[model samples]
Target: MDFLHSSWLIGLAIFVVVFVLAQSMFFLVKAIQRAKVLKFQTSDIKRVMVSTMIFSIAPSVAILLGLLALSKVLGVIIPWIRLSVLGAVTYELPATINVVEGVFGQSIGQRITDPVLFVTVVWVMTLGVLPPMIIIPLFLKRIQGRVKNIRKKDQRWGEIFMNAMFLGMISAFLGYVIAPRTDAVTGESYVSLLAIFTLLTSAGLMAIIGVIITKFNKEWLKNYAVSFSMLGAMALAILYAMLGVR
Candidate 1:
C-alpha cells in the first residue's frame, strides 16, 4: 500500500519480483522444450536454465526503465494518459496478484475456479498493488525469451522487438477496452463485481483449454497462454456487458 505513493519503489519492486518470476517460467518452459527435443540431461537442462535466467534479467531491466520513463513522460506531457494507464493497471491488480500468488503455490488453476475467493482476492488485489505484478512478469518473460532466443531460431532482433511491443500494446488495449465493459456489467459501481467473476471464469476456461492443448503438443500453449488471458478477459467482458449497463 505504501509503495503506491512511491513511484520509484513501485518501479523497482515490479522489476525485481516480476523479472525473476518470469525468467523462472521461461527457464521452465525452455527446459521442457529441450527435454522434448533432446535427451534429458539434467546437467544440460540446469546449465541452460541457469544461463537463460541470467540472460533474461537484462530485458526486464530495459523494460522497467522504459515503463518508468513512460510514466515520467506521460505524467509530464499527457498527464491524463498517465492517470488512465495507472488507473487501468490498478484496476487489474487483484486478479494478477491472486494469479501470481496462486501460481507460486501451484494453485493458479484451482483458485481461478473458485468464484468467491477469486472475487474477494480481486477486490483486495486492486488498490494498485497487483496488476503490474502479472503484467510486468508476462511482458518481461516474453521479451527476454524473444531477445535471447532470436538467434536460437534464426530470428532477428528487430522482429523480436516488434513482437514484444505488440504484446504490450495488446495487453494495454485489451485491459482498457475489456475491463471497463466488465466493470459495467459487474454492477458493483465502485469496483465492478462482474470484473472478477468474468475474469476468473475466463481464466478457468483458459487453463482448461491450455491443458487440452498441452496433452498433445506438450509445451505449445505455455507462452501463448498469456495472450489468451487477454482475449478471455475481453470475451467475458463483452458477454457480461451484453446484459445491460450497470
Candidate 2:
C-alpha cells in the first residue's frame, strides 16, 4: 500500500497530467488559428470558450465525486490519475470491484495490499479501455454510415435502435445496483435498500429537472441536470447511512 502513493507513482501521474494538458493546449491553439482564418469574431470565440469552461464544471464535479469514492479503497493517487485520464467512474469502479471482489475473492471496502493484485487491476483497467480506442478509430465511420443508411430507410426504426442500444448499456449497471447480495457473515441474501433508494432519488431528481427544463424553459439546466441528480443521490446515500437506513 505504501508503494501506491510512492513518489514514483506520483511522478508518473504528474507526467501524464502534463502531457494531457500540453495536448489540449496544442489543440486549443490550432482551433483558435483555424477560427481566425475562417474570420470568426474574436469576441464570439472568447464567449464560446468561456461557456465551454463553465459547462465543464458539472462533469468535473461528478468526476471529483467518483475520485473520492474510489479513493476510500484504492487511495487517492490511482483514482485521481484514472479519473483524470481516459476513464469514467462507471467503468473504473466496476472494473476495480470485479477484480477485487470477484477475481481475488476479497472485500471491496478493504484496501488492497497485495502487489500482484494491484498490478492485475491496473493492467485490466488499462487494457479494457484499449479496445474502444482501437475499435472506434477503425470502425466508427463504417458504423455511422450503416446507422445513416438505416435512418434513411426508416427513421423511426433508427431512433428505436439507438435508444435500445443506450438502454441495454444502462440495464447492465441497473441490474448490478438492484441485485440482491449475500451477507458474508450471515450467509443470507438481501436487497440493498440503500442502492434502490439512491437509484430512485437520482431518477426523481432527473425527472424533476427535466420537467423544469421543459415547462419553465430553463434550457441551461440541461448542462447540470446529470450532475445535480448524481450529487443529490449521493448526498441522500450518506444521509441514509447516518440515519441507519441500511
Against the unseen true structure, what C-alpha lDDT does each candidate score?
A: 0.53, 0.88
In the range 71-153, model 2's lDDT, one tens digit per residue, is: 87787888888887788999999999989998999998977788999899888888878888788999999999999999999
What is candidate 1's lDDT per residue for 141-181, written digit by digit as tens? 88777667865666586577678879999688557534543
The best candidate in terms of TM-score: 2
Range of the 10 consecutive residues with the lowest summed lDDT in candidate 1:
73-82
> Candidate 1: misplaced stretches above 4 Å?
1-76, 80-191
User: Candidate 1 versus the native: TM-score?
Assistant: 0.28
| Top candidate when judged by lDDT against the true structure | 2
